[model samples]
Target: MDEKTGEVLGRVVVTQRVGWCADLVSTMARSLISEHWNTSDVGMLASGEDAEGRALPSNAWMALRRLGWGASAPEGVKVNDRIVRMAQEQAGRTLRSAQWRAELTTGVLTSWPADPAKRTADEWVNVRAAVPGGQHLPSSVIKSRTQQIASFARANGRVPADPFELEGAPGVARMLLLSACDGQQATIECREDDPSRVVLRLQLPVRPDPR
Candidate 1:
């Protein structure tokens, strides 16, 4: 309740159909992420190149298509174009997310802790300083990177030389990231006729935006 305006502030409970949409989106996102969030595909997407050395399209999905690594819907599931757009949208975001991990990996590799199990204060400072935004990165992220390096050393003879050699890419959460967009890429609505079913709208640019 707001005393100043005499207006009550409360939560409005929408139908559970919203929850269904969320689950549906999550399932779809996971499939797309699994298909595209890998080293070979993401590496090509990042480089924007094809096997023949020709430049790829600016659009992530088009770049993927040029490289013959584009994602596809499940077998026998005829999804509409909007769904494909959502997959493209999510793939772009996932590739961008990999960049941070790539930087973090390089920082950790360059300023590796003397002991992978633990880091001294100086080692921690050095690593954080080496990374672009390491100071703001969570300690857990660094720790996970350390653990991966240590594991690699245990299996191989030596520590990894770089992020690419260390690992393909870090795993990211499977999400549609509707909040990140301006409602153009995706939108949600409840169907008055069928309260149990909600409508999720997805619209993507036919061509990549020229920025």
Candidate 2:
């Protein structure tokens, strides 16, 4: 059984009616270690009587402890159904290009523009006036801002240039522009018949689990 995924990777069934010995043998077999000891040797070991009617070897006691006091041992080690489905569901989210970019853009939609060149000082002031908590122009700027914006649009399901222009509306432009500003590969093109209209194209990665 896979502890993380809760998938039953294997199973073991014992028909014996013996008590502690049966449980111990089943557990050891499930753990893939039964072949190491002979059946007669195990019975003698479990008898609990040593030379002069004293206790058995200390090694046997230690082995029992290592097996987790019988019941506490790993569940799959004996039954193979130990891991529940819920355990697998708790693993970290899968790293997906589209999902990752979409999350980033969603965050960007809530943030103010951080670039000075792409956003004029007056524009920044106007935005701040409209959205009181909006962020102002960043002190340092990058020359690849346009490229980054294009890439983000492509990765997040949109055309780069148009995504920037689409958010040009009063207080939302900064957020949209910032979303397009990082970690993606994108391309921008203007309509042949209408130079005023721009098209942003993006490329998204395929998801492994279509469901």
TM-score of each: 0.50, 0.18
lDDT of 1 by residue, 1-211 (tens): 3334555534332223333333444455556666665556566666756889899876555555566654555454454444455555566667756766777877888998888888999999999998888899888999998899889989998887766677653443434455434465566788999989998664322222211
Instruction: Candidate 1: give the clashing pairs.
Output: none
lDDT of 2 by residue, 95-152 (tens): 1112323323233333335552365666545444543233442323222333455456
RMSD values for the candidates in order, in angstroms, are 11.4, 29.5
Off by over 4 Å in 2: 1-104, 107-117, 122-148, 152-211
Pick by TM-score: which candidate is best? 1
User: Which pairs clash in the backbone of model 2?
Assistant: 149-180, 154-202, 159-200, 159-201, 160-200, 167-173
